[model samples]
Target chain A: MPPPPLPIAPPDTDPPGIDQQTLLAALRARVARLEGAGREGHGAAPIPVCEGLGLSGGGLARAALHEILAAEPGCGAAFAAMLLGRAGGTVLWIGAGAEALTAWPPGLARFGLLPANLILLRAAQWSDALWAMEEALRCPAVAGVLLAPDWAGDPAAQALDLTASRRLQLAAEAGGGIGLLLRPDMAEPPPSVAASRWRIAAQNAAGAGQGIGDPCWRLELLRQRGGRPGGPWTVTWRAAAGQIDRESEALEAESA
Target chain B: MTAPRRYLALHLPAFATDRLRRAEPDLPQDVPLAIWASQGPRRLLSAVDLRAWAAGLRPGQALADAQAIAPDLLLRPADPEGDLRLLEGLALWARRYTPLAALDAPDGLLLDITGCDHLWGGEAALLAEAQERLWRAGFAVRGAVAGAAATAGALARAHGDGPVAPSGAEAEWVGPLSIAPALRLDPALLEQLGGLGLMTVADLLRLPRPGLARRFGVDLLDRLDALAGRRHAPLRPVLSPPDLGAARDLVEPIITRTAIDALLDRLLDQLCAKLRAAGRGARQVVLMAWRVDGAVQEVAIGTGTPLRAPAHLRHLFRDRLERLEPGLGFERMALEARVTEPMSGGLQSALAIGGRRDEAAAQLLAQLLDRLRQRVKVRRLAPRDGHWPERSVAALPLLAPMPEMPVGWVRPDAPVLLLRRPQPIEVVALLPDDPPALLRWRNRPHPVLRAEGPRRLEPEWWRGPGVARDYHQVALASGARLWLFRAGPPEAARWMLHGHLP
Candidate 1:
């Protein structure tokens, strides 16, 4: 499905810069390519793409992270390696309390990602959490961020607006770096100004003794500026080994 | 250093000493005596004048002038270091309220209690409780809550000159206030702002941004940005790192070691799960046993390393619980961990799997030493840290690990009577090299056995109260050995018993 066109201010044609349309186009292109390759069904249930490569496979979130890195490894190699290596960075992983921060490292590490690129600032209170988040956003050299929404719900509207603005500011400052806002379990996807949004969850696997490939998750490409929302795709991850694959369920397709 | 966004400046009267002096001769609380310290003959550096200050006399006046005004002015020298230490201790006590508390400029503190207000009911309640505690400690305090450091400082000094600004309202609060000289703003910038008819912060704030940026340097703009919340500023807190705490509640209270073992199993399981979830593990576990007889017994067991495993942790607690004197039937038992470290999942097993079996076994054997330490109440269980024999492996209290080298040692191979501390021994000998031909200990002469040295230890030249000694590892004829040393450089020496072998 095509994304709703963002209401942008009158055009300032000062060469090319990030705008809603450009983002939408990128999203659309990505969706079309996934559809064109006959990989849409397989995406919802990611299958091992190792027919020839003999590669290991796993779940979707890990797949996306790996795919993102495989596509542009050098872009975040230093940061990615640092986070995966368990070195520390200035990335503020926000959540309700100790539980949220505690659940992060292994989840990321399951995808062969290290939090070495993160400085764990556990914000027991919402106000300090905001302060920490704002501080992390402003700091340069902070590669990518993982944000877990406050359990108390959305922050003050002004603070949220400021944070959204900070996302753009951080992107501009870091060239190609991005921040991930992990929303709590949502009925419908929450509105965000993120470059993209992917819904991740654990899924059961078919094979025995495979340790259920990195907890398969369904990824719904909800928002992209220049692109369409790619149909939900299933991705499998083998986290420890950092392998990801796509699987297609024919029975589910027929039922749908 | 990370500067704070808000500061709560506190001012205490200099009457600390006068109160002490007034109490010397059973000083009456109502008499109003002032205490001031002085280096100069007549000048008073810091004063605690109950009568004069109460009568509107501020600190820093000459003693004679104060005496003229109030004849009973008590003078004493101020120990700034002591006052600072007291404030630091208070800051530690304040951490129960919020973790983001920092030291404010001398005699003040800034707590970044953004959302921690509810812990003590509300901010007002918290402040009231804090004030009550301090008042009991005999301090006169005036407090004001403001959003910005500048506003808080100004208003506190002015004794609640303005209302408390809600969070994010610092810009408005500070705008109406004057920028005092103590705020440390550049004089030139102040003059320039003053020239533009901007005596108050509001005047300076109302000017166009471009003109303000052009006139004043980036510092003013930065300050404005921080004040207006355009950019967030974080406070670098001086409080201790957050604790990793875990507790357990038993369904049924049981007192026996087996029952305690089961309870520990459940608690360790939950605690380790929490620690793993947080990417950390525990270094200390405190077990509290509530007895049916209205007495609560607590046994704290500290691990040499952070252990998150249920089984390994249970074992550590098992060793500690064996010695507890359970006076009554237990009603409830709880196990909690106090300290923790980053979760290193595979490091513990790496030794077992890496084929370094002997080294790992040695490490386990070393752990036996810790068990011995617990049983014997030896705080320090490590081999001596220095090359000096007498100072090596000096036993300390089981709870207090020594941070410095001790002054005595016992040779591992030497057969000697061990003592906790060195004591003077009387000996009669012809020369330093010769064995103590005769030695009088407890007024008895012991025949010479084999003796080691006048291994001379020179007096520490750089420090005072120097004691020189000539140490010898001596074995008595009756097979009772002694670690003896002669004091007083090589020339003038007297023997003493330093330590004995186990």
Candidate 2:
């Protein structure tokens, strides 16, 4: 299904001297300036080319909180690895409970994340994991932080409320690194102050004959603060090339 | 030629009695006291106080005979271990006079005061000062200085309070001393020498050297030669003090955290200065707090890398400060670097260049890791050489260097989330050797969509015998991919879910 069209201001509502295009450009520049003021030295980290074309700034803003939810059970690790591969410097991976022991280095290496550049912290509880994530996000040496707290089974577990996530966002801004919070797909997801919310699920590879090929994910942009929220796009990670490309483009290229 | 070596020997004759008096200050000072030890069938007086000596009772006399000589003699059992421990303590205290101090065993201390006498005016003044201090501490001490350790020890034991022997006058000084007590010879030999009228060392020296050696054996000659500076005597000094340490004794015992933190800050500053001067860094440090009630509490911290930055170390110790129980207030606090490593000095600049920025970032990361480790377990994964999924990667220390992996070695198509222990699953396959078509895991049934594999992984032979496993990567109907494996033959095969792949 196609996405709904963006709501546009009618032509009649424009001022006497300004056109719609000019006004929109002016507003965009103003937002860019406002956002750039908090994030200096660290600019936007470009998403892969196929996905970048869909977002307004062609990338995700650095030094900001972004949430990635796994609609299916096992696709979160690959999605997080794909995003962390684009980050520079050291990456701290924080997790709790049985989820903590699941990050296999060799598998992450396939996604272009070297084991040497990664520090794995296994927190004993959810609170400790959150504290570690905030601490890692505030360290200038760390370029990225992946917090995968296991909040799946227990409904009584304290969710990451707005205040907690806001603190993490501010810490990321101070340290100039991107923070990724990966959680199991929830019905409401409580409340969060993250800049963008994304839901991803595993998708079967289209062209592989009777075998699993490169990992493919259907990524959906649920909410974005300053960019267009649109997705459910099928994307494939080419491990050999260390790049992510749109599944359709990949197929077209292969056929050609 | 180098000047001759000088040694100062201190003999505590009433050490056993003195130690008891110091421990129990209420003991009667004028009463005759003697410590006895069992020697085979009979108990003998091992040590006697000055009062006992004045009462005509001496060590080596049987307790029964000593009681007959002095009816009011105070008796106590001999503690050889305790006496040796006290001697060791004295040796440590003697280090303040000179860095080289050794326990002479039983009730004596040896100090190599070769070039150290000048620091305390002269040899006589140093000896007088050491004797006065021991006397004030309730010990009956006799001290002497000579060019040879054995000569000094013999003079102190036999001649009581003797003048320091001039450098090359050891033979003359030891010539008039009694041979039995001065040379510390065997009692049987002493009796034979007594029968021959060899009472003084001079009488034995006047005899022919070859005849004397044949009569007394080589040990006596070795003792005589050592006393005359003809042989070298080796002294085993105590363990060296800590490389870097700082301590502060409070006039008013402090119990508040602020006061303790202030004290800790000053101590850290002093310790860091010492560390800097020695070109070293502390890997592990312990903070010891001595309470007014005589109880000691300690807290220790370790760093992943060698560090001397006081602020970073203080930060690491911040949370651990709560572990110390400051009961009745702490009278003293000491910080010691228990483990140290060599670290090169680096320049600190306000403006970081390209390389300097990297250095700063690395240091920041190390500090972050240390802080995180205080609360949780932090590690880095390193690839290991193995075909088995679990053995292919190993957890390494946070700051350990990652070695270069072997070239041309391709990483296997492993799952991202490898379970620590595989979960059992019920599986149905169309053929006995094919991949699973349907599976039940965690009590949930799922139909396998795109099944792949029977990738056989042989058990490591050197790790003992184990069944071979045939793994299959199956895509479930719910969009979850699972790594499943079958162990043993088809008739008795067991299936398990090992990992979740993306």
Candidate 3:
């Protein structure tokens, strides 16, 4: 049989000045750009948070899955709520079992997430919760999807494999929305395909003669796919300001 | 002026027996079947099948006598309710012949086929088609058409079958029918008339008017006049003519999901076209599939807002289509808009730049929510009117407009997670009303480093008297904040863990 023709241009047919390698590289780059544009129309802009937290792009990337783990008991939910509020569109909060019934509207409003912009979905099973999360993430009408699957009772069901997370990531990319997976800190976390991972711990904000102050958290950046991971920074959630403020700066301002 | 009114009446002679046969088609046809009813001391046959009728069995005959006559007679207790229900169902099914169909009680249906006859060619053709369809459906139907409902009904019941009586010929058509059975006269009156040799309706019509009035009551004259087309007989149709509905009868029964989906698409297109023309939208739509085995499977879907888009409506029905059980396939399907509301065209102010985008986004969100609702429960949270933590927020329907947050009611320091039910915790405090210094919850101990107030909240008076709860916000040794409450007096204090504050 005759040899199959080359899929691309033959060496002899290449332009005099431009080599095949350079041309191929340029073509590949263009194709990548086009594919990215097709998946995310107009490209999704990253959501900027406080500057000192050290996200390489100056913010959390959109159309990507981010894992938030609670080093303490309850800080992960708070952090996820703050991020959802910042995204500023319809947020689908999906949870399973008892975790589904824990979202308080008043508390959500404290983080600048209003009741009108939030849609709460409660699934009884972890699989259903994950499915709902993926579906919500794929809808362009939604701004973000927050899934907190409780598999504490079933040891076999606790791990969400890499394939499942990758599917969610792809769906998020197609929809141009953020995907936040909130979970409790595990002794040895299962393998994941998340773009970034963070650990949040509650910080005491009360001082002498001062009652309970605004919630403060110590946020630790544990992993970042293509950027430097640097955190363990203390920040106070100033509800009145509708943003997070550095703990030292906030305290100094309060005293001054 | 409108053309003279016409009605077609159908009579089912063996309705009770036929209903059972239709329900259980495996029943033996050669055997003599009878439906018996208890009358005081004796059980009498209320209805008998064709075979039983041929064997000289009759209604109102004693069951013992019937058994003696046919020894192998099949008997079933008469169900008057089931018989009437079947009759009503037949009346609804008869709507395929005309828009206005009404029940003629026990075992008959009346269709006001005034102008509808032309659709099936003519009155005779329409009657023949109706009878043919009914016969194919396992019914022995005798039908007649005349200028008046009373005349048609009387002729159908008396003559067993007849041709259409042209306009102004009701009297001639009913003249030859026996007066006693045809006009449905009282037994005593029938006996008296029989004694006087007045057997046929023509003979009674020939008698003097005054003497007939003096002898019989006004009801007798009323019946005669109605039959003669001198008085109008009104009918209450089973369905109003203006109801938005579309139905298709399949030549070959279909069982595959693809076929059903195609049929649904066509029906939805037809229904949505009607809705668009009427400048209205449906709020609730019902889809009914009639199985060949005489069973009907119905599924209904309701929309949060008026909708007429076929694609959107089809999407809403996609999930519910699986619920339809197509046993032995379906021969007929019907789609009806049970509830409707007037709808205007498109989004308002579509010409404007921002308004158009906003409207499109709102529509997209509504559609997304509708799709989510099919697989999961989607709800929007709203501030509720209550001081208790559990009652402070309410879950509203996804489409409901968000109500304004109640003023001065929400606490800025409310917990991020409020347990649906408070969990009891072991607490150690310097005083009963003070914040917990140490707490143990879920078999875990937490030492409180700093504490907040004992904000006392008294139970609402309308909720009946209850102990005031002293609530405290405390920071645990691990930096997690918890909402704790103590109830009852100092000596009998009970501590409960209520919420997790961020």
TM-score of chain A of each: 0.53, 0.82, 0.78
Single out the weakest 10-residue window by summed lDDT for candidate 1 chain B. B409-418
Candidate 1 lDDT, B414-484, residue by residue in tens: 22112335677888788765557677765788775555665666654554566766667554444334557
lDDT of each: 0.48, 0.80, 0.80
RMSD, each candidate, Å? 31.8, 10.0, 8.2
- The parts of candidate 1 lying over 4 Å away from their true place are A1-256, B1-35, B43-56, B63-90, B118-141, B146-151, B159-162, B166-172, B175-238, B245-338, B342-413, B416-441, B449-502
Model 2 off-target regions past 4 Å?
Answer: A1-15, A28-38, A47-49, A98-100, A151-155, A206-208, A248-256, B1-243, B347-357, B407-412
- Per-model TM-score, in order, reads 0.38, 0.66, 0.71
* Pairs that clash in candidate 2: none
Candidate 1: docking tier: incorrect
Higher-scoring candidate on lDDT, 1 or 3? 3
How far does residue B242 in candidate 2 sit from its true spot (Å)?
4.6
